[model samples]
Target: MRDLRIGIIGVGVMGADHAERVVRRISGARLVAVSDPDLPRATTLAESLGSSSAPAAGTGDGDAIRVIEDPLALIGNAEVDAVIIASPGFAHAEQLMACLEHGKPVLCEKPLTMDTESSLRVVEAEHKLGRQLIQVGFMRRFDPEYAALKQLLDSGELGRTLLLHNVHRNKTVPESFRSEMIVRDSLVHEVDVARWLFDDEIARITVRAPKPTGLVADGVLDPQLAVFEMASGAIADVEVFVNFQVGYEVRCEAVAEKGSATIGLGVDVLTRRAGHWGGAVPDDYRARFGTAYDIEVQRWVDATARGEIDGPTAWDGYAAAAVCTAGVQSLQEGRPVEVEMARRSEVLG
Candidate 1:
């Protein structure tokens, strides 16, 4: 099998994990180089991947990965056949454009960008490139349970899809995290999942803010509800609370004419003592979705090696961004905001 040379543009938590998977877990792809603003961190990660310090002619050496300050430089490097954009959301547009310009396939993290207009620009660029070169990192779509649920829905076992309900809760996020609202940070996943499950664009969105739970009074944002109307007339409700004390839990259910199917939360049992049954809850996003992330990266690597864009496309990213933008509006207005989706171009397909 020909190895696909890939380079990651960020060395942060998620970026580092992608590097690890590329080197250790994935067989179709090899970590050719890694670049971050912090050269020291990049070099350390490269060394840990069993690469050398001296950069090779085409690909970097075994002990060292090419550490560069400019992410665009990584995209243009001869060694990097594909690029993974795990940098900050704000930097995604520029990095993605560079990759597409170089005709390298790219797997970018979710939201695509902070706003819809920027996301549209990405879509436009991919359209101009005349091929599908961008895959947005919506990992939940690759989750086993979620995939099962989608199959069930598609099989018509649940009868007419009338309503969908989801709960996304985080133990807590920092106070400074409010820079991005619940729509961008917490509810964005729900937005993506709901759309993917229903295979429809959200037509309307409304946010209902309930009273804050006592457990999170330190300006902690908890329990935000978003109601969505799908283009197919399906109604979906999502409750996102970042300060839910129980554990990092994600729950979803689809209500249909005959019956409903739901996803289980947490592990079966963590401990049985004192006449009590307990199950461990994940501490953060990374833990809860660790398996999903692994599957996502592997799929991306495999698909890229096959010269195929297998995951979420640029259209999905733009649609999510549009819905999220409307979600922010609905939260501000405290009313249902109608979302208008642009026509999908052939390039996006």
Candidate 2:
């Protein structure tokens, strides 16, 4: 396969990690350029490319990573074959729209956008283009355990799934992690996973935040429960605790009429001692789902090279945003919030 010159927006933790992964870890792609509001951060990452970088067109160094201050310009760079949008969630809709206009394949970090209306705009625009150019970064869809569960449910080996019990625990969240983020940032993964596995949309959501964890300075809700009522009459309840201060963990159990399946049982190195028996838990998402993210990105690069869009689509991103919006609303309204979405076009369907 030919190497695809890639430009990534945003040089924050996730963006930087992705940039390094593409240039070093993943195949068939090179980090030619990067953009971030913080030009220094972008420059820092570009400098750190350390001989592995491929310079953007018109630049002096063919083996240098160029610093593109304006992310939009990077999207249209003649040297860039594809774009990766890892900017803030709120910046996603505009960046995605730009990708659509340029007819460039994009792998956008999820939520798609922080709201439904903006996400819908991207979806509608992609539909207007008559091609799927955007693939959302919902890495769990690529996780082996999650994929196995999805396959079991799809194969009828589990009969009909009746319930899904999900748990998302983070050892700690940064100071920026706020209350509503419990739904927007954290539970958003489960929101997408539930939809992917069940092949159904979430109809309603009820969030319960009993009390603040008080672990961090932020008064954000923690150790909360979100109940999702799926269109297929299946129920998925997710427990999202961001300040567990223990370890990062994600688990799911699916109950079916015939049988049941469960996953996320600490797939790590186990230890045995005179008085203890336990396994190492991932300290963060990068540790737990690192392989899944790699697979997702590799598949995206290979498929895009073949003129195809793979993995989660714009519709899925829009749907997850809609559900997440409702989840936040439920948190505020103190009641069940109904998920509202626009009609799905035939192309997207």
Candidate 3:
């Protein structure tokens, strides 16, 4: 099989990792082109892939991969069969719309858009296209533990998932990140996970911010709780902490009519000479969900190669956007916010 020519739009942390994987690990996907606002960075990344940078027209020896400043120009490149969007959150909607307009398949990072109105535009464009061409990168569904738990739920072992309790904690975040990014950036995953796991839309959202602990310094919003009411009448609760002062951690438990299934921490315990047992924890999300990321990328490539729409659809993105919007409102108003979701015919069909 001929390798699928892939282009990356961002060369930051996540984007660079993706480019490396496509160049080094993946079988049928080639990192043919890369674009970043930073021209030198894009050129260096293109060179590292054993492909030189191409000019605007992408004309050169086939060995040259184009490094462009404009993301839209990269989208229109004939050599790019599929695009991976790991750009800033604010750029997602515009880039995705361009891809759909060109009828190119896109794998976009999550939240679909940074805000609700932009997210709606993406939804409207997909509906107009009459097919799902965008796959939102909610990699948790690809996670092995989460997938196993979902399988158990599907098998009736967990019977009628009643509630889900999730915890997401990070040791720290840079002070420059907006205070609200804690919701839009960090807790957004929980919002998506709730929808994916329960296969339900959130009906309402409420947030409660308690007094800050000394453990969390003045500038940090250490712990925040988000309450969700699912359309299925199930309840979901998430606790997010940015200053947990420990290794990165994520935990989830599903309560159902029959039994409960939980995600085990990916850690091994050892006995210390001091007479205490300790286990090592993952330091970051990449360590925790690295396999999931690989699965997500490969699935997108495989599905796109077959001209099939797979992975999280645009509807999933819209739904998560709605929930996240409500989450923001809940935090700001200090009251429960109703989540409104538009129905998608593609999702039903």
User: Which candidate wins on lDDT?
Assistant: 2
Query: Considering summed lDDT, which 10 consecutive residues are worst modelled in model 1?
Result: 52-61
Q: List the residue pairs that clash in candidate 2.
A: none
The per-residue C-alpha lDDT of model 1 at residue 210 equals 80
Listed per model in order, the count of residue pairs whose N, CA or C atoms clash below 3 Å is 8, 0, 0
Query: Least accurate stretch of 10 residues (summed lDDT) in model 2?
Result: 53-62
Per-model TM-score, in order, reads 0.91, 0.94, 0.91
By summed lDDT, the worst window of 10 consecutive residues in model 3 runs over 52-61
CA lDDT for candidate 2: 0.87
Across 267-331, the per-residue lDDT of candidate 3 in tens digits comes to 55665777776777777788788889988888888898898866888778888888888887888
Compared with the true structure, all predictions reach lDDT values of 0.82, 0.87, 0.82
Query: Candidate 1 lDDT (Cα, whole model)?
Result: 0.82
| Model 3 alpha-carbon drift over 4 Å, by segment | 51-64, 213-220, 268-274, 345-349
Query: Candidate 1 lDDT, tens digit per residue, 187-296?
Result: 88888888888888899999877876776545544578899999899999998888777678899998998899898466655788899988788887788787888899
lDDT, candidate 2, 206-314, per-residue tens: 9989877868665677778999999988899999999998899999999999988989998466888989988888899998899898899899998999888889998
